[model samples]
Target: MPETTGDWAPADFERHGHELLATLRQHFELIRDVPVARPYDAAELMGRLDTALPEQGEEFPRILTDTWENVVPDLVHWNHPAFHAYFSTCASFPGMLAETMTAALNVNSMLWKTSPSASALEQVVLRWIAELAGYPGDSDGLLVGGASLATLYALGAARDAALDYDVREEGMSGPHAKVARIYTSDQAHSSVDKAAITLGIGLRNVVKVPSDDRYGMRPDLLESAIARDVAAGYVPVAVVATVGTTSVAAADPLEPISEICRRLGVWLHVDAAYGGLFAFASRMGGEAEDVSVGDSLVVNPQKTLFVPLDSTALYCRRRGALANTYRLVPEYLTSVHTGGTFDFMDLSPQLGRGFRALKLWWVLRSFGRSGLRSRLDHAMELADRLRELAVGDPDWQCPAPSRYPLVCLRYAPRGGVGSGTDLDDLNARIVKELNDSGEAFVSHSVIRDGYVIRVSLANIHTTADDIERLWAALNHAAEKCR
Candidate 1:
């Protein structure tokens, strides 16, 4: 049948979808052939498709053709094997399928009454994630867009619990507003500061406690800070500890921090956005790090859990705190299904929660515990291999060892980081050369004030060969610069 300008038939939709699938099949199979991202300027792309809005409907095939020809080239292929930049996230086959299903279903999972299956599945999926993280399966939580919002929600609950006044009902504009303090390690994600700001806890009130030599938060220092704040008429609200910090993947000593928070009567929220799932990959038999030692904890599935973008689960041990902080039902949203089912809207500011549970459920189902472990173990091994390569090579150095699949390396050559060599610029140029090579893409970070190249190996498609190639490229760039 010819292309239709009118409403397309289901048969044609199916055919076009298959065509797109065939294209994606080749795209994935031959992903290595494509660049990680086109290093072209916006003007080049903007100059190409600068046409006005479409006046009439186009055929599905033409739309597909346009997408493949015009759109796919410019996007950064995070799924590419060599995309080791940032925390590599993989939208697995099952995850993509789940996305399609979710979009088609268009589930508004705010309340149990809205979509019973969505809410029920969310409860199950949240519990499954908590268990995987070695957290309490009985913990109450909700899926959020990302860990940032999760932190905000968790902090909101913490604020409500710590404050004697009803900050939610009575605005902080009153003279009764006192300096409420939120303490976190210097290396924690900026989400902590953001959450404090959003919660009317004030950015100035978020104390940045210093970390130890290994970059873990010093429990003594945190205790001292809280004590000092208390003496100064400040209320200790919460402590945001990190499982894996963004800059160097340094995890704050949660056990000690949790003890401090609990003893001091302060709420503890773990920002395990990057490294919490280390538990999910391998149940630590002898060397386990339990992240559930907090009032609330957040883990991002998009980070290492083979899910697509924008999916984070915030689990709170104090279910009442989360519900109390955000629960407010207008007459319109009043649901009679409150018998046993939870209205997820009461757990956070979100009135319309997507069927994000589907993404996690499908990904979890597709890759069972053993399969997930194998994939994460693969990434971990590759990271170790890269570090080993850096050690063996005379021109490179892996200075900061990460517990996760994050490796921080700097080109030091035979000598130290280089006497008058401007090491930072050299490393930055090396990263530029690697990214410009289009063979791979890796990011950079500063550890202990020294600039270093960061290779985050978590992609499902990445292999041992890719690591070697990236290492070789690093050396090649170093050689050219030296």
Candidate 2:
């Protein structure tokens, strides 16, 4: 049969989709092949396509072609092998396919009755992730957007468990007004503070536990802080131990942190957003580190497992605590509930959740455990190589050991580039030069009051050649420094 000319027909859509996919792939190829380009010129883009909204509509093929020409080129390709900036993952094709299918189905997995498969899949996938993270066999967990929400949920559980008030039902009313305090390493992600603020816990109550030389939170400091808080009539509710710190991938002493929490009778939550997956690939028994030391664990498969974004697993040792914190079943919503069913509504804050688990399920089955392990192993190996390269050169300094697939190094000009204002300006210029050149993309962070450049090797496609290109770009950027 001839192709239908109008509306959205299956065959017609598929044909156009294939063409669009090719165009998308072509844009990615350009990013991989020519990693560097001048900034997008506004006037140049204005000449390529329409500026105003269409009154009626245009052909799908024309839209695709125009998008390829005008839109795709402007995007910074996070999937590019050389995109070593920030915490990122180049998601596998299987993950992309799963996302497409789930969006097409558009299942809302609020409860078992709402979408049985999605609810069940999320439960099964969360359990699988928890096992990989080394959570105890008795633990239960749920899928959340990412670490931010995971922390919020864990903190919510802390509030509920410690105060003996069902805040979800009680509506933060009569009881549960105790001054709650949470602790995390000074180097921990800023999400903890944000979560506390949203929870109505004062930001001042989020104590920054000092770190040891390795940058991990100091157990001694933590204990002293807890002791002081308890003495001052404040409830030491929760302590967040970071598995992989955002700045340098530093790991807190989990065993010690857990012990401190236990003695203080406080809840322990491990924020391993960046580094928890290494627990599985690390000599510690792949994914097992996530479960070993906390009442709750937050792991982002999206960051390290090549899964797409918005895939995070929150594993909790105390299932009752999670349900008690978030469960809310109105009479109308409970009508579909039959006893002994797994309803996700009891564990998550969302009433209408997407089928996010399908993507991870597909990726896990497609790659298998061994395949995923190999990818992680390769990333760490490449990171070690980069670390060695940086440290060997007198022009650069690897200030800290990169325990995982992330390294932070700073370029130093020989004979002293400048002093005072000039020194800071030189480092600033170096960072801009490297990013603008795009031979490699490196992120910047402030450590001990000095700016440093960071490179993360989390992509499966990253190669030794890519590492070499990063070094070359660093040298070039250093030369550009005043």
Candidate 3:
């Protein structure tokens, strides 16, 4: 075989690494001055990126230069302080350094034997996450790529626990297969529906419970839906209660929903991916007690904790449910220390896992609880400032009540009594104009037949000034559109 190793010499590695580090530092220093997103024509971007298979490898410096020149401009700079679209996150410096070290180590943390330190740190970090969320001390959790996968894993555990049939051994096609139903509020993320589809639960079986005035799930409606499904002879397998909804960040009434799930003997899964970190600040207060009733809960440190992307934890009270559903051991992969030690591969669908725990550990240790809480409180304050501005302005309407750093409002001229289509068109144009202007970025959502703008203040760099500038940009765009 030809020589396969491409390891860089020590001096060369250090030189290139320092150069890359400088690039990152410069990017962050000038991030606020850059546009939140730079729209590129699909064909033009493909022209720049589409290439023939090279028979030889290119120089590292050349590759890095090409990426900086061609790829960086097309990125949607989520780190920008003015990035108000969707949920925002900050890849903190400490987290970035941890990621670099993790890459250099390149450990596959699938099994304890594969990387003992990675496995132990993962366990510790997961416990820290559970404690931070005030979850039961006995709760067990593992990290996944993102909230979507985390939801999938949690639901897999729920599926096995809720059904009498062995889904792993016998499969869903067994004669005992029943229509498994999942219930979530209309405002829940689309990932819930996706998880159902992936788990062999038909999308048609996923029921959308109606939301109350504040966009939170109505407990009475949820109970009625469960009762209706049961009356139809369908098994209510799981109910996903969202603590922080995507559109308005409305938290569902967890206590009542949990009580209903308990009465119905259905699995309760809480999707607190976006709002769970607020637990640190105590902004959630007694509302978080709802998590106590959940069989499984998902929290993403990547969302608001200044960690790098793709660090999500799925905590399950029914730990055996996950292993029973996902664990499979062949003779080749067996180990001597298998009895008490956890092989993360047994709990997740992934067989080869990266050492993602280190970044979270670094971030958590760097910020500590007090530091993180302070940042979260600052975000909440900025959100409140935006809400106050919208509520005070006659031309702007705060349609939904925000429980977190997400604010949903509409720019409604003439007290919003105008034609629905006209208002929708206007707001849509305003969003497009704002994005095109490169001043700030905010997204839109439709609620109760009215289009509203959604602004999230989750970035650590975002401040009151950024929120004020976003308001000014929105008004300017609205004026131009009008």
Candidate 4:
């Protein structure tokens, strides 16, 4: 007879499932339409969790409830429409539902035999996203936890391709002739450097090409950088271009960079962690059709899709290149059934993979392409509105007009009193003051020569009114500081 314990039994699970669903429904309702939490409760919540560990297990439901009561109240609610801190979003309803289902099924999509449907769905979803991203020609994809992992995986593929396919099975111990060099813009996310370092391609191997005035990577500068590296006998293996960079949403000149990469036979990887999805919505239409310029590409639906956290995708134009880089076959893991189905372990580093694709699939199907696109288009509209407001205001300044749904502005006080150092100090104080207030939240980042307040619009429920309230709060904070 099989041993049954705790809530694993069928009847027990059914009862718990219903109760848990009810509790979740209540929680979601409150989270979806309420102020994240009352101000001044951070210390109280932390103190409650400071209690000693129990010697025995408590009832699971009670523990769950305790977590909700104690832990959740302290969480910075991303779901709140007015939450403009950092790069974030209030994930969609379908994504939440899908996450629940993913956990319940709990299939690890490492190999075909482990979970056939899961592996298939992953491939299906990848194709769906690739098409949505406007990349043509034999592109393949696999779900990752987020953009960080996706970039890591993309570089691993680049590394394999650069090293002549010998590194996959023999590991890095073998005699490799090339000192692999990766390149990215100064404005590129720090992940590029981190990925290089983690992959044994040291940070020194990762070249930071200069960006143009708009904070975008200049292709001419990139070509010059590559030439200089080549002249120094450094093998240029990869060019990690940015579609939507971190500090500001600046797109690297992809067409020229892609042409250069093609001419040089270097692997191109575009890290569109925050901005790639907007390729589908570009006003330039045919001119913008050239953003997907690489052997591999990354898109973080989690960032823009209103998909919950921990959802990212990596795609390769040629599937064989990705699989060839990472695939390893020990005798136990070898598969003879190579008829049609794909094993995702060959494509990624994580062998024990969760069913992350389901959340995206659910969101896509639930909302359809038009529905999701509408939300994204709305975010762009909102960003433009914020830009207009900032530019129109004498007390505020929008740094530049680029892509994606963000406005980077610096608060300039009256009388030009705080023109330079004083203005920056005031802006810094303003960010803290608003965060401390806990009514409305806005994040800040320094760009170019001034301190900036970045209003990143990602939440679907955030309306023009919400943006208005956010701006009002910011002005009020500035006034208070003055």
Instruction: Estimate, for each residue in 38-104, the C-alpha lDDT of model 1 and write its tens digit.
Output: 6778998998778789766666778788888998888888888899888777788999989988988
Better of 1 and 2 by lDDT: 1
Query: In model 3, which runs have C-alpha deviations exceeding 4 angstroms?
Result: 1-5, 285-289, 415-421
lDDT of each: 0.86, 0.80, 0.85, 0.80
Residue 407 of model 1, lDDT score: 90
TM-scores vs. true structure, each candidate: 0.96, 0.92, 0.95, 0.92
Give the Å error, residue 92, model 4: 1.2
Which pairs clash inside model 2?
Answer: 132-287, 133-287, 133-288, 134-288, 279-287, 280-286, 280-287
Per-residue C-alpha lDDT of model 4 across residues 1-482, encoded as one tens digit per residue: 22445446778678777888788778766653545444666577668788899766566688778877777667778877777767866688789889888999998888898888888787777777777777653577788887888888888888877776477666655665567899999888988888988888889998899998988788898899899988988778789888777788888888889999999888999887787777676442534435466788898888888888888888888668878777777788776667687778888777889988888889989888888778888888888888888888998888866667877888885577643558788889888787777667778778886788887889988888877877787888888886
441-461: candidate 3 lDDT, tens digit per residue:
778888885888888888888
Candidate 2 per-residue C-alpha lDDT over 1-482 given as tens digits, one digit per residue, 9 for 90 to 100: 33345567788778977986786676556656755433666777676654778666677887777775667666566777888877866787788889888988999888788898787788778777766667775577778888999999899888778765555666544565678789999998989999888887779999999998888899999999989988998887799998888888888888878887888789999998888777668444343343477898899999998888889988888768888877878987884556657677788687788899999999999988888878888888888888899888887788767578888887775677655646556767887788777676777777773777878888777788888878887888888775
| Model 3 error, position 70 (Å) | 1.3
Clash tally for model 4: 0
Candidate 3 lDDT score at position 104: 94
lDDT value, residue 226 of candidate 4: 90
The runs of at least 3 residues in candidate 4 whose Cα sits more than 4 Å from the true structure, single-residue gaps closed, are: 1-4, 8-46, 168-177, 282-289, 418-421
